[model samples]
Target: MRFSSRVNAGAMNPIAAQAAAAKAAGHPLGQLNDSNPTHHGLAPQFLPEAYTADPRGPLGARQAIADFINASRGRGVDSANAPAAPAVDPSNLYVLSSTSEAYAWLAMLLCNPGEAILMPKPGYPLIESICNLTATRAIPYQQFFDGSWALDLASIENALREGNGSVKAIAVINPNNPTGAYTKLGERQRLVELAKRYDAAIIADEVFYDFTLEPFDGNARWAGEQGVLTFSLDGFSKMLAAPHAKVGWIEVSGPAEDVAQAERHLDMISDDFLPMSNLIADCIPAMLQEAATQTERVAARVRGNMAELHRLLDADKQSGDGVVDVLRSEGGWNVLLRFPSSIDENALGLRLAHDFHMNCQPGYYFDMQSNGFLSISLLPEPTQFERNVQIILEAVHRELA
Candidate 1:
């Protein structure tokens, strides 16, 4: 019996296999790559009534989301000079089961089989997996790092030019996973211009939008951007620490005609799946209203972890050659640490797991170009995170010695 090639391509990823093995072995793996908020004790509390509410997710839920986004935008705007940003239209939003589903729908909406979409390199591998499932091609453009990660716009142009007009969309993970750098205003403008030049759509995965470490002065939300068709994706998973709830959304915007047409197509696609669960959907308003408290808890944890990491690095530098150098992250749940050039990341990960009983994501898992980089989560329990960092430092030092 012949099977579809796309199905074959969707095999279990290596990192997942490693994690599963550790779990099955009953090892107390010091998880330093966890992204699920539930694992970090940040689960959202829902009202009892939400459980038996309408099976169709309530309209109030979408309105709550629209209100949340607009408030967020207002906060980001400079009150002294900038005009109040327009509120996001609730009608423009479509609920989904996960960001993965949002991407899948967008893939179907934009690409025919074998067509291409541009993705950022040193980014999450989920995009490739989604593309594989949809029979679309994922073309990666580079994000170069100096002091901070920045888009290589030239590389993006090159991908589009050489794509032979098959590139249908550009996907941006704002405050990208692992790297944690937000897209600057100039970068966004250029991206819109490029999309217009190529007649392509933009997909901004702003799941980590609320986790910015620095002050945001520009328009932080992407749902109201003009000139190019855009789909800004976010969800309760990250915002409310409710991944188990499985609620996400796509906010569509552009020229009125374009947005209207896209909404129609999206409506049909979403209706066919009817992905979101009513319980979580009905709880959206309360979850969002209480989001700031939950967010502050996460932010505090991340900041504490970051501060400790920097202190450790500084101590190492004071003693001798530093064993690990942490790249600066503007926002996100993970931090990237670069070790000695001689070490292989995969071997380092294995050593950390077997010898240190700790597990971390190797940089290569995120398409990082180098061998010495390791990505560790900032979302782990505080005490465990500090202990893990010490173990990692000691192990690296012993290796270098």
Candidate 2:
């Protein structure tokens, strides 16, 4: 895959190369220029004795992530119907503070000024915000819904045609935030072909892949995709439901030459910022050990709440003051509640917040094309979620009345 000109194209310097060789030889050469207080016999109890600066992040942490991902991939798949997931390599992974940071790094790695990245409409605003911060254009491609959300391939194709090689990447959110729709197998194949044809990379955010609600058959992850260059992102925040964990990573895969070049540029970009902290890197192994249990715990919460929502909506349907539909959700913690179109989403959002003392995000917040849609999280405790649904139904009913 072609990278942006902003990336550092220079080769490794002599000093760093020598240091790498020395380290590989297992010779712990004392650094005359070592500036770390811990290495100099200060704060020995609080800090690591020495810093091992691997620009892709600490080797042990990356390996732990790789193992966890490889194991997790097969756990959810039915091997009888699908091919085995390709093995993940620690060298191909880059640990960062969050998926948001990974997005920024990718934006820099792929886009030059005035170049573009295609983003899904009715998607999270974070992608567009990152584009604006990096001076990259965010071209919107449609994700329309009939019974389920599907990508508008024509829209994406047109954007690539219009970009004329100026498009650097195509960003896809698996099981998209509010929509909760996973990219199907056929869709994935077409997307790979599109990226290959346009000479663009694919940036897939699969943080919500594990929380399957009502996914279609043959749904799968974008990581380890070999058809074209792809960067797959996931993090502890979503996997463990611990936002404070503040850990995320990107796994790069594609044609060998493209992967190598992308990694070289990414290493320089990561070294420039040195974003991952040694302290957090040290905790990754322990954190990963707890990931599967936490994932199951959180998955149960979301699935239960989704069922509660359906029960409440079904039981309350006879009231007839207004109708609210829970749009088909395949995966992810949130779902779109489509209310009566006569009520504007903005006004309803305000009413829920100001008068009802309920905080909610309106559909417009995600750039949904129409009104009267509210995005609701399925993460609350069961009784509280039931109560919240009742309140929402009452509010909509009152507005319609």
Per-prediction TM-score: 0.83, 0.94
**Could you give candidate 2's per-residue lDDT for residues 313-335 as a string of tens digits?**
88777664438889999999999
TM-score of 2: 0.94
What are the per-residue Cα lDDT tens digits for candidate 1 across 229-346? 8998988788777778678888888877878767756655665665466565767787787778888788888888888889878998899867799988888888899898798777
lDDT of 2 at 229: 94
**lDDT over C-alpha atoms for residue 279 of model 1:** 63
Q: Best lDDT goes to which candidate?
A: 2
Lowest lDDT block of 10, candidate 1: 1-10
The reply for model 1, stretches above 4 Å from the true place, is 1-57, 75-78, 214-219, 275-277
In model 2, the Cα lDDT at residue 48 comes to 43
Question: What lDDT is reached at residue 146 by model 1?
Answer: 94
Q: Candidate 2: where are CA atoms >4 Å away?
A: 12-43, 75-78
Clashing pairs for predicted structure model 2, backbone only: none
Q: State the displacement of the C-alpha of residue 319, model 1, in Å, after optimal TM-score superposition.
A: 1.8
